[model samples]
Target: MTKFNTTAGKPPIVVSDEDYGRLTKLATAALDRFPDVAEELQIEMERAQVLSTATIPEGVVQMGSTVEYHSDVEQRRRITLVYPGEADIAEGRVSILTPIGAALIGLSAGQSIRWVSRDGREHVLTVLKVEQPVASATPTVV
Candidate 1:
């Protein structure tokens, strides 16, 4: 069994202003269609670890993650967990609001998460490795 860090007393995750706005709208709309789901989302938001381009954990992939998953649907997918307005299906950049994206959040290499798509299809995704993105060495002239 993998021992994931127990998230206790950790500050709630933060969302970008843009992302928060979209989430707020979605939450409001869901209040009528899926009240329980909306509430659960609220909880996730409260416990979320907010990060900007900076808060992205080192050695962890944020949006624009190109990883290989081995599951019932074994295939190489360049998955991206982006917010609305940032999602590009053409590039395989899935929105964080999507089912697969929701399951992939916070997962690291060797970790597997079971997910059911919106169509009720079940699948498991195991993160094999994350390609390190090249960081610009030049310091910004602030």
Candidate 2:
């Protein structure tokens, strides 16, 4: 099996501590049902540079961030990284448990990574843009 590579010299990835904690639990629970994906998620978490949610860079691909990426075969795609429950392919929402989603987490704009899909095909994805979710303002009671 030709596994994904995070070999030396690749660009570093930054993940928020909140995301890390939640994703860790998700991966652990998926170990029995989705071993390959769980393993990949674990590997990503192992190499991630974890930061606090407030400290994470705006351009980094975090959960719920909308990202525009260029793939070697698929060309350009705009996808929102979301948890499994919120994933909807028709709406361009990708699940964190999927191959592409697992590969995209923590990556920053302008970084490119090569990952193999479930069908054993390798694809190179380059992040073109990252749109972080806007923080909701606190409601004030008059």
Candidate 3:
């Protein structure tokens, strides 16, 4: 089992070992171009329960997962979480480097996160569903 550093007083988050490594490098690389979002992602990772994908709990969000979330500032939306290179707002493919993307990473269905948007507006977002892409490398969570 994995553990979260609750001493940080934040909600628990999970991350696959593979995602952790890649996202860490991604965060570092995005520092110059996306400092705020990158820093937010770094903080989420610091409190994450790092594990292998097979052991990732059912409903947990990960790379390539399609997430259904509700926000205090906007209507409910569904989006596929993807790497920055794959992001297309028109296609509902969101980048994990964006504020909402960084906020959604590692969250499970029913989990809610409070974060600030790029425009400096604070928002609360809740994950209503998580669908791992059928073509993903990791086994799908039930």
Candidate 3 wrongly placed segments (more than 4 Å): 1-9, 136-142
lDDT of 1 by residue, 1-142 (tens): 1211334432223444334445556656666765544444444454556556565555454444555556767676666565545778898777655656655545566767666556667677777776544545752121
**Which candidate has the highest TM-score of all?**
2
What TM-score does prediction 2 earn? 0.90
lDDT of 3 by residue, 25-135 (tens): 899989899888888888888878999978988799998899999999778999999899889999999999988898889999998887777777778899999998786
Tell me the TM-score of each prediction against the true structure.
0.56, 0.90, 0.88
* Residue-level lDDT tens digits of model 2 in 1-142: 2566555645689999988988898999999988888888888988999999999988999988999999988779999998888889999999989989999999999999888788888888999999997765852111
Stronger candidate by lDDT (2 vs 3) = 2
**Pairs clashing in candidate 1?**
13-48, 13-49, 13-50, 14-50
* Model 1 TM-score on a 0 to 1 scale: 0.56
After the best TM-score superposition of candidate 3, give how far the Cα of residue 110 lies from its true spot, in angstroms: 0.7
Regions more than 4 Å wrong, model 2: 5-9, 136-142
Give candidate 1 misplaced runs (Cα > 4 Å). 1-57, 131-142
Candidate 2 differs from the real structure by a C-alpha RMSD in angstroms, to one decimal, of 4.5
